[model samples]
Target: MRLRVQGLPTAAGVTRVLSLLAVVAAVGLLPWLSGRDPALTVLRARSAEQEPTKEALDAVRSDLGLDAGPLDLLGSWAADLLHGDLGTSWVSGTDVLPSVVSGLQVSLALMGAAFALALLLAAALVAPVLVRGRRSAGAFAAMLAAVPEFLLATVALLVCGVWLGWLPTSGWQGPAYMVLPALALGVPAGGLLGRLVADALPAVLDERWVELWRGAGVSRARISAAALKRVLPQLVPQFGMAAVGLTGGAVAVETVFAVPGIGRTALGAAKSQDLPLLQGAVLALLLLGLVMGAVAAFTRRRLLGPALRDASLALPAARPVRTHPAIPLTLLTVLAVAIGWGLLRDPYTVNTAARLAAPSFSHPLGTDGLGRDVIARLGHGAAPTVGTAAAVCALSLLVALILGFLPGVAAGAADIANALPPVIVGILVAAAAGPGTGGAALAVALISWPPLAAHAAALVQEVRASAFLTAQRAIGASPSWILTRHVLPSVAAPVARHALLRLPGIALALASLGFLGLGAQPPAPEWGLLLDESRAYVERAPWAALAPAVALALLAGLAVSGAAYAQGRRVPRTGGAGSTGSTGKKKEALVEV
Candidate 1:
């Protein structure tokens, strides 16, 4: 049981044991986690492409040695890991590592192309923040931020690949096929980078050296470089996060773009319950993320060196002035009201004669294949989209507060919750409740709360450790009273901020679920479902897809923008509400594709 540095000790053994336990949870528990009998389910899986008779299932189980003990299975997997074998996929019956490598290469290439474009775009956008001001930069970021990668993918496919016949619409054809997917990924990450750089630039620009440089008639480009030098160290964490977020978000993007990547592979593995493939993909992604994070951390320290000793040398806020979410919140409200007005003003009145009409009079966004008013369906979708998001955020916040204060519950819940991704949770809900709007809301909340609770739990732990809480404890305050007055109030701002940040993610998860046929079914006008419906007519009626894609992306952007505005205003010198990059951390949804 001993572990580490060269044959370690008791404490290390405990840690190793815990690590083994996690491995057990991840691999040993997979069969039950799939909500099926492993032998039977694997035999009948979509990937299997055929149903197995009982005798066949038994024979296959015997061949695969599913009768082995959990520990034996673990040992087998350990042996496989030692040999770098991820096991063969049940579907293809080929070596999984090779496919995984191919997928990784695609994902990395896609993300690599994205990273380069992001840097250039970020530089261009941050330029204005240096020479001009944030107004133009902020406005532009908001505009681009409004679009999610999947919607971006659909649009690019509709316009460039399909309508114009300029690019291939499907497959990993070549570098030519990569452009739309890379651009889809790049634009949002670039917007994030620009926002981060802009946030870091203000104080650097305000400094006296900059004034001297300006007075001495230095080129704005050179001056901007100086500002960038000061900003670069602070950007490391955001950059790392952007990369991580992009990787995490790649599942939907890769699937939509028909790109063979780990994200898409993982989703397929999950659906088929391909335990080894799924585990390998998750482990690889987790390791990749860890490496990226380590690099970011090391680079941050190296670049920050002596500057780290000075808080004054850290990145500056977008505006030191108090920021209210009033404008963004107002915008959200106006959108809701407008959508409601549309719903009342004949958005849903269907006309067969107008079916598949292009954008023109009487139907602004044009008619879908169904002849349903495109604008009406989009407008109708807004209610469920916004309402479901609001409800889920509210529920998640409430759950986070309750579980976060209870140490036992928070610790146990976080472990279980983090293990299950939104898609898996949505599928379970879809199975239990059947596909519909109510189940969709529940699915969103079901997938949404775990991470939020984990955040709240950490915050609560920090608060409980503080001197003020200890002092209150010494005064003989009841745990409940202390939790309510101290813990609740202390955690509220962060919980609120976290909720705001998670909303768009939740929205996207809902959309992804709906895309997979687990949410509101077709003809329901749910934005995500609308995308599903529009896929068939995308070539002939591109606007069918275009309308929902635009609306949904904008909704995500506005939600995120609201969170960003709150973070800008609320993050203070005390650093109480987590990193300034809090919103950016969860902005994974937009770029995740």
Candidate 2:
């Protein structure tokens, strides 16, 4: 075993070392690369009141360690990081570690609560599909993922926070205060889990052992349990991925809810261009993601064990396949009807007088800045915003899928494409397209490509080695047929999971662009546009800014929950046939087929 391990050609050790180095470099450089100017700006802003005397300026600089030369600063920064000191915040003129640590607790609380809720919600929502064979579950998950998290958060804040007065507008006052924000975060994540579980189940169902179980007269519940158990081992890694992705949404949510979390702090710092704060926040986030990923990988290696080893060694033979029943489609129909009804009725109608006024009952969702009906505007806005996202995701996924498959089919090009940095692509595309719908779309497409490409490449590799794909190829199946029937179907589960996982981040990016005056134009009724408009009112009518900010956060949460639910639903399990089967037999069957 030792000889074989040593003789293996894989560069896992090198990869691990490189990954660590990359992380270190990234964390170290952020303060210098993206933070210096901001730190200086804040220092200068502080020093302005004291006159631009050299002593005052020097004092401020010295206080921030800016008095040191760049190399010395970098060295100092490295040394501090090595000792777990995040350095002092230039903006706050305080030690960075305590603030970061304090903020981290809040963020983690929000994230953890949201994640737990999302998982529970997803399990309940997807259970019907698993037990009852309903396809609507999948569509509902898709639609949920389609809705932007910012938008969802807005609706929740208005309906739940304002109208119903069930929750406070902002602030983490107590445990109750966390509920709305957590739910807002959890809904989209749960939805993603549902979609993933839904998609992954079909693959497990198609496995030959499942047929054997069925032949043994296993009840549907028993079959589902078995399938779920088998798939759970694989599903854990996805949970980590979801957590990583949700970090961004969590930030937005925490900000909207006035949670005083790291995310909120980061946003404040970013707006003022507080370099050290921004760098610290971003580095912390990156570190969180890396840690989650590493943990997931380690867990997977530990749990799967020999099965993984065997999978890497010998490919199994193909067997007849069976399609699981479609998810409950009727649920989607009902949801659509509800959404339509909600749109038609006076969603904002407060009282009898308001309902009966001249301009009353004018619009269900009310009116915006241009005297346009809010309901009508939302209806109109939905198509463009949501539709653009769908288009962007599709385009991005298509590009990624093509790139991913090319390596399997044409090796060299795939290598080159994979080697290219997505950020470079994004910059190039953004530059060429310029700001507008076209530019926004191009940016989203480019930014979304990397993850999709990675997933697709892995899926392609898996499909290439799968028994079904190989069997089809051996039987002289056309390349297209092999791709469509064998490869594509096999990859669908992961692709759907990937798409849902990416949606919130992509929407946030789009929102950021809009906030930067690059995506939606003025008076467009977009969340980003609202944020831009409300910026001047930050101190006075802070609610103006708060409203949109909260909305963005909620929308992000919904996207995360939706994605999490979908992903969870797709995960496979393992268990009994007809509620009675030997543990060894079940385990063997799960492993064998």
Candidate 3:
């Protein structure tokens, strides 16, 4: 019997087209939904010093054709798009195409460099697992993955640019300026993609054919290549995800390094409320995302061809390893203690006389430029940052569980949704609802579901193909019984665990949104807001920034170590040191979710 591919090419194609239309409609509706006067915004953007007056605003509105309704404007933009026109920038009055194209060139170059770095890092992590059968590298990779792009970029800027002066800190001047940003964007993405690759390696290696190749004396290089091929089809989606990640991550990285990329341009456009330019930037990113998703889907189809139905013939079971959770637990304890200790002080209390003070017995983490206790802010900030992250994770899990069962819908939707990263989503949400912690949380939740959904869909497919389920079906077990007894239990646990691991990254994304001024406003004690507030004063009172920064890093590290312990692999104890005989049992955990 043939297994029908989920949402065959035609259905997926239609889904993508609809997704594009939906995004266009949303962009067109922004002005109306936001309830902001486009004419006044344009006037201010063009001449910030100019005061808004009825006559001037009306003249500007008449000149720009803002008198038309949103639908009418959308129709005009669509018509122009068909004619290879992308409309004009509201701020600069230049054709949007040229500016967008220029930004894309720089962004693509940065993304390419970042992709290369990611590949290198992935290879570094995967090579040891494939060649030496060592799984310890996974824990390190997890740590690498947990570091947020913004934090990493800031560190790179400080060390490479300021302290060592080894590379340019900010600009798109030359390749020298690209290094830090590329590393910032690539490292976490590499760690993420690499761990996934490592997770898939076990099942591929456990195949009987792998043993046959070894028995036949196939060279190690040849065998490794074959193993990779077996896993590549499954990994294509992840590769697409990594591509989206790099694209979205470029926003923060570019801002830090001051690269003239589309992301930065879009961010600037949003801040200045340049509707046309903002629309163009989002459109370009959407197209890039769809194109990348298409490429991944096409590649997966080609790799599988028509011969590979029921791909999960044998779902490899991973024996859990003994892991001590003490370290992760300890790290978390320290953070909790710090926050608890900080709660005793008034975060709002300002001591102007002690502004930017260094750490002292009176002030544990010193004072901010505004003279607010860093410890109190750090303590108070935990609720918004961590709580929202937790909420986002929970909502994402629910959506993932629901969408996971609908494989076709999930696959197509993942492609569309993955394009809009948290920052991009925040841009849209901020435009619509106004920037605040609530909107930022909503934005994070919107983009956070796709990964979990994809994971659920894959697991659903695998569990449905399992022999036990097939046997039950043959024996006349009802569909609901099989689903409830076998499917949900199998899919839910792994997906929830995956969501648990993602908690820190989610928090980081929220912080990033805040840092970009799309989240909690100043004086709210949001971690990202605090980072933003202290950045200018970083050179003077490094302690103010360092407090929150250290808290974030510790949070990430705790997640990594905790995940490592939770999913620890069982290593063979009795195998001879040089022996490859135990290689077949050396599979990484099956769930890299």
Candidate 4:
């Protein structure tokens, strides 16, 4: 009789155990390593003051669990962790876990609100542009991504805090204080999402199913919806990754805004070398990232299964492409109008008047602590924050395109360049240029290189394998001619997509740097500087911090969402009539591409 044994080894149990062990090691060892040198040095310094009696030394050692062996230390830590004892904060003399939990609640609320707002704004902004086939929208989105969140926050703080004197510069108040920070965060995210949708749409257009739907007399709108559904599953993982990065980046952002969130708490802990608090915060963030990742993976698995099962089915016939001429012009007009209206508003006058008078019919958005009109400040602030981001995006994209193109043309050299660290380039450029706009530009340019290189390499590989490219080469066309006529055109969509995808993250990072005093200097209305100034007043008037913090968070959220939306809408159509595969064969499509 055949034994009813399992066919393969059940590695799931082993994997789970190993994963848990890894987590434990990471959480425990990292803090120990970071604190060890400083702790030992402190101990040595203290030893010179007076040699403690052996009994007293032993008592202190036992209290800190320092006398225990490695295994005992690990066991004690694990036990404490399991028992909800996160240890005491060296600085605050309070239980670390409780403080972290309280701080996290505020952070979660801010993050959740900001993220939701961003997603909504992104969808709204991107849908119309994508439906109308505006290529410039993608570029605009990329520009938004290029501006850093720290820079945006700083600008907001300066314009709103200093010039208008409307909002409090630092501290948490309530939901209202979150609006500006959230918007500041969301705008860039929205811009990037818009670009992503634009890029993804072109790919969807080339899919056999889309063509089939069109041939079957389905409306373009319906086909678009179906394509979005298919592409969305793939986007989940990317969104999760972005979210994870945002969590880490949020620390600087919250600190800059002086918001009483986990990020601010984490910063405080880091400064004081509060090992337990720091570790706890890091672990919580890690767990959050893991959960998001798992959800994304599950969604991808489910969506990919059906796509794979329908590999060989013949697609319906293609329909004629529809192009819109007025959409781009109309969008440009709207942007111009919005900017003009903003320029006409005077924030300082509004703030002064509002402070002298109470809330009335004229000031609908209400006055801040200094009696500044919120509407006027937002209007004035929009110019610099949005304009700087636009400039950064354009400059970075240009740099990316140039660098990206190099890899496609010279693979070996490109690979070498790609391997070079961005920090080295940033340092070199910063040294050459002083820490001003010039340095910011250089840093952005350096950071942009890797993404561009990767995209260029992929495009080159794709071009090398394309039938059209091969045919052109076979006919003895000059390399320049082939590249100009065939290769560039084919790779345009992917290149555009990559540029857009990088925008929001780049912008947020740059903004964070600016907030941390590494970017723009004083006298300029930067969000980070405002937060720094407001820290002293945080306990008394939390609204001072809350306002700018919320603004920053919102702007980042919007930028990311917009990019994702844009990517979702774009469908790749080059190389073949409707083939999804790079080899021009019918097969199950995975969401990876």
Candidate 5:
């Protein structure tokens, strides 16, 4: 939470910037690494069957800088970059600079609308703090955060466009068409911000400063303002991270709404595997996120000013975990049954007779372009998608437990792992594993564990230092017994909760890779890969795309619900004010486990 001098690069910040730069550089080389002749792919994209003559190939290699050394290519691109040339599109044979410029405007506009709506929604959540609805607000946010923006766009389309006939479903019409999409994007974004706000606020209000204000006969309104002022700086990072991820999330959102923003451009580039366009778009998004983050951080600090200072007084400790409904468990149960059923059937069998049919009695989810059952593929995909997610969460929980006992190494490794965005991790994993569902699963599972591991490790370390654990050690309890019986059982819920919370992230990573044709290849029927296959025939068969998206969102909801359920459990509170801790002295009772 420490803010260095304005524009100073902390070791972590520098590592992040370098990581992104490396990703962009590595991304540029992907077309060459694909094992396809870069020249042939470029030529074929432009012509139906351009004869792959040696002379023609050689000319292409020269024109596209394919034959140049990496440093030479970098120098060439750098020179071009100075002159405002982002190179030409491999497929379209047009300058990329103009496209990037125009696309940035569109993305900014779309993002602005989304942010405005998100801010309003966030403001409304603050009301619950004054009232007595903290638990209810948390539940609401958990529900919203569980659902992805794509599904939200789908629901908006169904209601505003189809059901009410009040808005257009698929276009970049004027602001009218923009409203639903903005809402679709913003609500979930805001839900997360609300959760962060709520989580941070109780601790702020519990600060000894607030008690001092009360003792000094300060007005309640002033004390509340003071609490919010202090909490606002903590929010800066979350807000920026959310915005950066939202830019990436926009790929799905824009695709669903048919908005002509950078997302759709990136989606097209991904599907076409157009190297220059994809690289340009990826670089743009990455740079956009990094730059926007820096700007947002500066702005937050400048605005907060003195409020950014750390308090000498101990803040309110964490709140007591509350109880909630079992909706998540019930929902996950239903989803598990569906996936289990899918595991029993093969979705790849071609049924040409029902080719391209709409949803009907026999084909519950309808048929795809090749007459394969969509439901079958979706069902079959469940074992990989959901099952992979489950495996990841379980693995993360296990790793965190083992590593939690070794804080120094765990914290440093987690910090490094968490610094790299999931997209970078996914792409690297995909490249290493090659193209298959199993590879995709492994890539996702590997990338998805870090943040959860970091959080879990921090919490676990706190648990390990408690009085109960010390007492257990003195009671002739072996380390093995303490970890297996005492530690694992106690920390399991929190770890489970973190894992469940990561489902949307897993879903997003899967879809991004799937869109790039790097996910489960033909007949595997993964939702993301389904979306990829269906994009071409969207006009002919919209349901093909819609079904998988809805299913993915539904599953995400179930996962979040499961997390909420885990969070709501009445667990034994093991540590509080009496415990000597990591951060500082604990004046207030804040339960650790």
Candidate 6:
């Protein structure tokens, strides 16, 4: 047997190193760019009563080495990072390394548990779809995947902790405390991974090898194993994405459960404007994400094995095909009705007498603790929440298309951006621009384009490889003509479909940040802001929380359904709507015929 080892290309290694440097540079430069006097903020954090006179602020800045220019400070910090020094916390006046290490330990444990749970859930969901060809199960998983981790964390806390009294509500006391947070992070991630697997499997099963295995009387178990092996490599990118999701989702999960993980630590540091601690936290999370991506890449290489040498092999890929319309159509109807009804109510008129009022003729969804109508807030919030999400999606699609057409430009930057989650980006944005809707939108847009870009890039490569494209090239057709007439039509529809599916996720990310006071401010009636406002009064008035929560749930359902319906409705001229080139739908169609 010939043994061969595959490693990341030299270019990729250089790209990664550059990406790391870029992140470190950004972290180092943040305090200087933020405009807020870091010295004053540190003084207040250390001693709130201390008068921030010029002398005091100057002393603190000199002591922290912030008296230098931004580039000089960044260089010094980078030098310290090379020598294993993480600097000192501005808040606690202690070494940042120790705090970061302790928090990293807790966050790593939570992330590991959550990722394991996600895999288990993915396996369970995929097993049924693979064995029984259950499309309904896949559809259900898609909807479940759209749910935000914060919402899951909140519901799990209420049902499993407060209501049933089964698990501890908060704190990092022991394993018991980990369950709720893990469930919150894992379920949605699992659903996403499973959806990808389910969509890819039908095509794999239809491969001639499966028939050959059956004809040779190979055991069902062996055949299934072989099929999974073929499908698994296609999931490497998604696995990395799932890893990012687990870490990013931890911010809200940790906050909701009061887990002393890095996410919460980072959040606290951001709020206090503790540049040292926040820098350490961001670095740690960024490194962890890249490491996970590397691990996934390594696993994919190992899985490919002989396939690496077999140039003629045609590996199966996932495709977006037709799906049943019932679920999506039903979800669309529900959202429309809810939004229309809530539009008629007043969201701003407050009445102290009706505070925490239950559902009645006057207020269908009841009133918040501040006596603002729940349904009205939810209805009014839809425009800002959904409109901003749509804008983010549109911007991401634009970026994806540009990057997709150009092969290598900004690829390293995309890697760096992918390492930072929307929430983490939000922390950075808030540090510089202060918290607001515009900053939140920019933060989300920064990290949201990588996946779509990957999709578009893959599509571009696929189309470029096709015989028709080659034939056109052989003829007198110009590159621009071939691209515009052939490539754009083929690439645009599928990428757009993928971007459409992301609307709910972008909205959720925005809401999660808003829930953490990093997005829309008060009186705006944004869905996430409303949820944040109501969380404190959840026990006193469940309706206030439930109204927005239910509304978010409905929104998730709508996105999933709408994406499915659109994908089902459109017929691609070349490859499938899915970024993956799997012919699962074609396989199913053959079976039906």
Model 2 regions more than 4 Å off: 1-27, 34-36, 44-48, 53-59, 62-70, 206-208, 214-222, 309-447, 455-509, 512-527, 531-593
Worst 10 residues of 1 by lDDT: 584-593
Query: By TM-score, is 4 or 5 better?
Result: 5
Give the alpha carbon lDDT tens digit for every residue of 1-593 in model 3: 96768866665567766776787788866766665788888898689998899999988878877778777777877788889887888888899999999999999999999989998999999999789877666667767888888888877777677778899888888878889999999999899878777766766787899899999999989988988877778778778878888878898889878899999998898887887888888888877877787788788878777787435434355434335788888998999999998999899998899999999999989999879999999999999999999999999999999998887766666667887788988988888778899999999997788778877777777667666777888999999898888888777876887898888889999999998888999889999889878878766787887788889999988877776677664355332211212322332244454
For candidate 5, lDDT tens digit of each residue in 386-411?
66666666776677667656655554
Overall lDDT per candidate, in order of appearance: 0.68, 0.57, 0.81, 0.53, 0.66, 0.82
RMSD of 3: 5.7
Candidate 5: segments with Cα more than 4 A from true spot: 1-14, 45-49, 132-134, 203-223, 303-317, 320-325, 344-346, 352-375, 390-450, 456-497, 500-504, 515-518, 531-550, 573-593
Which candidate, 1 or 3, would have the higher TM-score against the true structure?
3
Q: What TM-score goes with each of the models?
A: 0.75, 0.63, 0.87, 0.54, 0.79, 0.90
lDDT of 3 at 506: 90
* Candidate 3 clashes between residue pairs 3 or more apart in a chain or in different chains: none
| Per-residue lDDT of 339 in model 4 | 39
Q: List the candidate 3 regions with Cα displacement exceeding 4 Å.
A: 1-14, 47-51, 302-322, 454-498, 568-591
Cα lDDT tens digits, model 2, 1-593, are 34446565344344445645644554455444452354446656566565556666566667667667666777787888789887766666687778777888888888889889878977876787687656566555645544444455655666687668887868987998988888878887787777666645655677799899889998988899877766666666566666765676665566556788876666566555565665576566656666776777677667667667345321221121222223223333433443454345432223433321222354433333333443433434344455667778778777777766754332323222223222222222332343455666675675466556656666566557655555666778898877676666555545655675566556666675555455666556555655655444333333444544544455454554443344334323322211111322222122200
lDDT of 1 by residue, 1-593 (tens): 84447654444345434643664455544543445556765576534566677788887677666767566676777788778888877665678898888888888888899889888988888877877766467556655655666777778788788778887777897998888888888888888787667655776788889899989999988988878878897678668877776775566678777889887877677666676677677666656565676677688777768657445454443443223677677667866764764586555677788889998767777888768888777778876776787888899889877876665545444433444455544544443345667776785675467566666666666676666666778889899898667677767766676787677767777776776566777667788888978888888888888777766765675665665565555433342322313333332211211
Clashing pairs in 5: 206-316, 207-316
lDDT of 3 at 171: 88
In model 1, where do residues sit more than 4 Å from their true spots? 1-24, 37-51, 69-75, 133-135, 207-223, 272-275, 306-314, 320-334, 337-384, 398-483, 516-525, 560-593
Error of 5 at 427 (Å): 7.0
Better of 2 and 3 by lDDT: 3
The per-residue C-alpha lDDT of model 4 at residue 250 equals 55
